[model samples]
Target: MKSDSTVLPDVFRICFEHYNTAKNLPTGKIKNPNEILREFDFEIKKNPADAAELFKDMQLYLKLTPNTLTPNFQNQLFSGLNQYALAGDWLTSVTNTTMATFEVSPMGTLVEKKLIEHMNRLVGWENGDGTMATGGSNANMISLLVARNKMFPEIKKEGQLNKRLIIFVSEDAHYSFEKAANILGIGLDQVKKIKTNPNGEMEPSHLEEMARVSLSEGEYPFFVAATAGTTVLGSFDPIDRIHEISKKFNLWLHVDGAWGGSVLLSSRHRHHLKGIENVDSMTWDTHKMIGTGLMSSFFLTKHNGILRSSHNHGGEDYIFHESEIAEWDSGPSSLQCGRRSDALKVWLTWRSLGDLGIEIQIDNLFTMAIKAKEMILEYKELELMYEPSSLNICFRYRSVSDVNTLNKKIRHRLLEEGNFFINIATRKKETFFRLIIVHPDLNETHLYKLFSDIIRLGNKIKEETEFCMVKT
Candidate 1:
């Protein structure tokens, strides 16, 4: 039997081998719940498992999981992995420290602070403040909370009471905003969806009209969230135009840049967020675009001390003590008590790539997006649902009748085949494939293969359906 120390090293080696070979393998194998339950032994027994059994379990776990690093993986908003970021994540797990206090996590605290400063500068906020969130959703929720507290300070102590607070967001905005409103005591009905134009950009005129209506109806209009990149269409709301309306109504403006914030690094693409600096707050998820490890999200604001004012409460006597370094403590400004050291991975990734390297990466992705659009147009069978705006490319296979059902069947067959991993989305009652191009390894070859497979599968399914109908 191998010693415990030796076993861990061996396991690490196995994991490294798996990681290196994943790109060459199929993206994933689709397994239903019953198939998985029968294939793997998941029972936690009365006694501790032996080393050999544990090792086998680890191997099985790796084998069963989907390979997100492969170019075929265009499923979610994020794909691939940054090697430097992975190293930082490993170090964080080994150290195992919370970011609640500077005393316990000194290096972590400074790294997080410096990273926030650099990100804020990119957003054109010279002296802004921010903190790492669990994910983009959490950061967005925090934005709502901070905006609410700052606008209605009395609500913190006195509670919402009879106050009917209203929030305005584009109809194409992330669903997280609706969840945040519910979590923050703002009723779902109070979330007014502003009308969007044909291109999916928010109509500024409709926003102002709604704000006026809210005020007249005795509802307190507070926050307006503009999406930097909408989920399905990847549309960026006209931030400059929206800001004018926010100012007129004294509404807190927040840009949800979770999927598109990294565009700020690209000089050419930064125009998407033209009036970002003027916004009251913003949510950025580096993990989505930069390919950092999961959960590298930041909630940034121009107002430096608002986070402390909004979230700080209790913990003074026990964890927070009076000291020179007390100001460095992140607990006061955070919604969590035991936050993980998420900034180290992001900081390390930035340092390894530098601003110029990341800029080039973003620029290259935009170019690739254009290539994808061109390819979609080249094929007669494949139809482009919307023009390429950012990384997301929404398209579907053309069919004579029952186009929606045929496309859905094509996607389902593609997943079962396990050669590719992409996603399907519906916009305006029409279904299409939402291909997210974030992985560095993705190229023209992968895109060609994906479309070829989709077309081939679509033709086969259609022919089979026709044959069955003729036989009947």
Candidate 2:
């Protein structure tokens, strides 16, 4: 709490200590959450007086560190944490600055504005506008807010009537879009789900027919959210065809590329987002694909200064002080106040990697997916749900006659046994393992063993399903 420079060493020491502990800890038997939290709180409360008690030789705490940095850690979209991203985050916290106003945070505001413009250029919009959001979901919500404002300009000043102003999305789209509709005071029922193809891509014709049916039923169709990369399935709805439908009906186009947007950097995969430049707005999360630590989400638009029009709250008498060097603050144009300098992390990442590094990372992830598919096909016991569109692979083991129960038993056992951790998802009432291939270090050998372990566990647990179900 004294000189900032003097305190920095302790911060670095403590951070690295925790990092090493997490990296070295045992993978089995996740420590009890409640006990760990109680101990952690006790440590926090004794902070200045007893920092040593909280950590002794780096063996403390009750939470699983989730070794996402390790190649075996494939449960999440973001795997390895970039050193530049962490450096930016630590500096931002030490400065303890808020990004509300240019005057209060001149450098931060400028950095964010410039970053927005830089991102806009890639989307082929020279004059597009945007705001860095808290997370991908919040960014998706902002997209809905902007679209609603554009379609019903009055809603900005005069709230939404229960006119059933509907929005359309594919069945495979991220669930955050629904949360956005609910937050905007649009009932959850107002979100219409269009059917998708076997590959999980949204059917454009189905969307068109659904729009016609909505119109026939006298419901207002105002927005359509297309997914560039779905969370579980890793599917992309055709942007070009979806744009055609949006134009035919004058609907606002919002692309949720939270998980897949970073592919924009890849010259080869860029064609997958062909008509992305035509969309009204987009939600992109650098944290997911760029490995920029956590929460690097941006809500971007083609229309200049449209974000300010949609979200700028009224009467800034205190923060937006006028002066000879007056500048507009980011707060007035966002739903957040006291925003962390999230821009710093993204800026550091962009500055360090530039566009090419990001492209290589993306291309490598897709290439890894290709190798993963080959490995899955080679194993006679496993079945792939669909071809991976990005980095997630949905597949299950195909054992003898009664295999589903065996596969489910193996997955539950893997989590309990805890040599490695993976996720499972249910689609059309069928449950299957969902392997994420985001980390660059995860090669074919790791995946091969992971699949092998599942089958071994499946055979091991087939006899004790009834006993283990009620064991824990």
Candidate 3:
């Protein structure tokens, strides 16, 4: 726990400098293993290295890593860390505490509870229960666990019964639902994929029919997951229509809003999740939309006390003391015993922005998404794969032949050039770049630059191919 006084200051100086200059740096440069080895001395030695030498290594590592802070970096669901969120993260690290008990994490526990309460109310739950999860995937699993335990309470002690338990989700929903099924011992076969419309929203009629078939086959249909924002197409399922069917079948309704849940803050875009409050549970990640840093995910439930009852193990007598505040412990509700204080960054971001500031941030991103679409339509070379429902805008460069191949090549070349970092996804056998406009500073200029880069690289590839064919 001891170090040279100058070492700490030197490390902070490098980090602060990088944060200040990241926007000006390259988004990322894809490097092969040999090239990376040449660039960085990544070997571990038995002896401690000089502090100055280690600091230099840190700088090189940061330089080589993708600069996600830049507006051009849109490869993933999240971008741009809020300054206050970073400050809160530093504070949490310095404190070095677990969130298992209120006695150990008094402020941490209160912050998590306050955030959960605020988010629950927004989801239309007046008196609901919730907990911070490790990530969106973990939150989705928690929802499934609670739903299963609630329907078959005896399974807690007796284990799963002979009856096959079934869960339903849209064909385009996040893959975490299926993963959760496997983890919960609900066989992959029991995770039914409901049909989605061309826009990627779940078809309520198809879900109802599938539920009926499950019942006819004597299967236990207990859960239905609707997506607020699917990964590839950024589409929102019709929650109100889906709710009607869930009620008819007596299924536990869960909304997976990990990507687009922040739209709840937007007065204009909240309608996409109009009936979210009616759902039994929800998964929302503030980090994805609000720049609250990583792992700011919450699993909220309208059913109070369900999570604690479903997960409580009645741990050792030493840990679970019979104190008045023992009920405030979060360990029972969470999947992990020693959970990190994930809520501090979220609270700091929320407090800095307030509700209205978050609304403006989301509203602006939606506006930019529409603008990106408009620009794509103006050019014949660029094809808009699907109308944007959120910030994800999928499109590809047009080629008379090998359109998919051409788009893939363009993406690869873009990464190699290290000018921008975006991602591509395939839907219905077509591949296109899934441009994310989540970064707050992202604007029309960055979008144009992206399109220009793709077109430029795509045309170059086509010319080279034509020349090869002519020579042959």
Model 1: lDDT of residue 345: 92
Report the lDDT tens digits of candidate 1 across residue range 318-402: 9999999999999999999998898999999999999998999888888889999999999999999987778899999999899
Worst 10 residues of 3 by lDDT: 314-323
Score candidate 2 by lDDT: 0.82
User: Per-residue lDDT tens digits of candidate 3, residues 1-472?
Assistant: 3477898788888888888888666698888889988989888889888877887888888878889988988999998889889889988998989998888999999999999999998988889999988889999999999999999999989999797999999999999988999988998999999999999999999999999999999999999999999999899999999999999999999999999899999989999998998899999999989999997999999999899999999775767677889889988887888988989999999999999999999999999999999999998889998988888899889888988898888889999999999999999999999999899988888888889998899989999999999999
- What are the Cα lDDT values of the candidates? 0.91, 0.82, 0.91
Q: What lDDT score goes with residue 194 in model 1? A: 97
Q: List the residue pairs that clash in candidate 2.
A: none
Backbone N/Cα/C clashes per model: 0, 0, 0
Model 3 stretches astray by more than 4 angstroms = none
Off by over 4 Å in 1: 1-3
**Mind sharing the TM-score for model 1?**
0.98
Give stretches of model 2 more than 4 Å off. Answer: 1-11, 17-49, 56-59, 324-327, 400-404, 463-472
RMSD of each: 1.3, 3.3, 1.2
Per-model TM-score, in order, reads 0.98, 0.91, 0.98
lDDT of 2 by residue, 330-359 (tens): 886788878988889889988998899889
